[model samples]
Target: MTLTLTVSDDVRALAPGFTHVAIEAHGLVNGPSNEAGSALLDDAARRLAARLDGRAPHEDPHEDPHMAAWRQVYTAFGSKPSRTRNSAEALAKRALSDAGLPRINLLVDLYNAVSVAHLIPVGGEDIDRIDGGMRLIRATGREDFVTVSGGEETVEHPDAGEVVWCDDAGVTCRRWNWRQGPRTRLTEKTTSGVFLLESLAPMPVAEVTAAAAELAGLLADFSPGADIAVRAPESSA
Candidate 1:
């Protein structure tokens, strides 16, 4: 079945420049992280470093135009950008840090590589686990967001007016991509998945499409014979 994604009108008004591309694939070959995956992450870090162009290693990630756009969106939604950064900024900081990015599984590593190298937000979910069509919308603060705390399952609610990605099940991601719920996250055994590449103003739709293409290529390489489909970047505005 084809997975559907939509950005609500309210979310478009909140961030008029919001654009996204979706990649859905089946028959994937996922496994433990390996040498190739580590190499990809290393190369992505180098690319990000080059983009920084001598900026102080300790400098805030929001200095980048794309990240700055995300910060503004976060503020518009009543979230403190500093305390709750989008996934791309968080990954970029870790990539530039001495500790470097963590090696998750092959699929995670591949998507993270694309995200850091392109400096855009990219996320993957196990397609089989999604309940129905996913929608990006402002939360009512009463929707359930199932998560893990201290190794136990827990449920939390998003703040009213906060942007979230949800489906028939519940909130899959909170605070406009700040955190992904554990329910639909990709895992080592995942054979089918959907990846979303998101961007805001100052980052052209062309760049977003390019990032999605790069990710699709990487997925085809790592998961040979997988049926991959790349949707054109669509603006919420």
Candidate 2:
């Protein structure tokens, strides 16, 4: 059972520097990097570039007004950037201090390690094998997004145009490339992971790319590997 990851062209267009950097780094290692589990992430800098491909992103979240706008939406929608306060994320952070070695369901470990490894936000779902749906598009100004734990929900659309990734069901994830769906989420029993990689303001382009790649690499490293890829925005023109 090989693992597979995929990304949208929108994301690919963002981080030319990081992608180039990763490719070079892989080449420098003078070895093989299996494609199955490798992941990719991109945001502000990469998206606004002219070439639309490289190792370094063009903009940082803090400096990108578009990103800042999304942050506001993330907050309005009841989701927080990975930098926000959350007991679950905090606990996961503490656990990583001694994450030791990766030896769980290949997909699970792949992204979980990503969570701890880059300290950026990476999310996935059991789409290929799970019994639910996911969505990441913007609300129709009348969407009814029911969260994992029943509670009030709010959302803000991005100025660069909201990049939504949804399943056959509802809006699982929101924003162009932030947050994730709680429904299509992964579990200990997960064997195949379909994920969405993300990075937010204050985090470096290098870090996000590395985190994304780590997941992709881990998937490739597994006996039963995974699918790794990147996704970007649809352009604001």
Candidate 3:
């Protein structure tokens, strides 16, 4: 059950500084949050909230340089940044204001905490659910994107040449890291999965590597005996 992941030439040509860290873990115990993990998430939320203390997310200071690069990716895909913000930006904005981050599952909460703390967009997908391999590439506009909207399952398509994460099935994520498809989302049954940490410059490859290591450490502490493999920067299928 090996998962192949890649970043396409089009994406690399668009953003030369782009880099991703992938983590493949198995034997995870997915359940409600545990005491230690919950505590870590809480502490991270508070610290991130303090960092954004009274400023709205739309302001210049609220913008993360890494996320800003993603905005450019969205623009290249014919999406407006004001309308569809990258996931990291939206989460940081929520933490900055009264919205606040809510606990989902253990895996989601852990990645969300890291996303806010480091201002990087992190994506987690259930490896078992993914069909074939995954690639970061420009879309062809006919690919299916299965997602849930208003409690209903629906299918959407990306614009031609839009940046997306896809598999043999269809689009896994549209507009880069904006939203994840419902088919491959992480759930309680997800014991093994792949997590990606995306970064752009001035963030540096070293920082992204450090962030991936931190996530691997947290996963180790929470899922004790889980087998985890960390794939470093520039690794692809």
Best by TM-score: 1
Model 1 agreement with the true structure over 7-33: per-residue lDDT tens digits: 999999999999999999999999999
- Among all windows of ten consecutive residues in candidate 1, which has the lowest summed lDDT? 53-62
- Per-candidate TM-scores read 0.98, 0.44, 0.91
lDDT of 2 at 157: 35
Q: For residues 54-103, could you state the per-residue lDDT of candidate 2 as single tens digits?
A: 32422222223323533554565455645642221332334323432333
Question: For model 2, how big is the CA root-mean-square deviation?
Answer: 11.7
Q: Which parts of model 1 are misplaced by more than 4 Å? A: none
Cα deviation of 119 in candidate 2 (Å)?
A: 1.7
The residue-by-residue lDDT of candidate 3 on 1-237, one tens digit each, is 668998898888877778888999998877776666567666766766566664553453336567777787678768898788888887777766555677778888888888877778899999999989999998889999988889998988899988899999999998898889878888988999999998877677887898889888888887899999999687322
Error of 2 at 172 (Å): 1.7
Candidate 1: C-alpha RMSD to true structure equals 0.8
Question: Which pairs clash in model 3?
Answer: none
Model 3 per-residue lDDT at 129: 93
Task: Arrange candidates by lDDT, descending.
Answer: 1, 3, 2
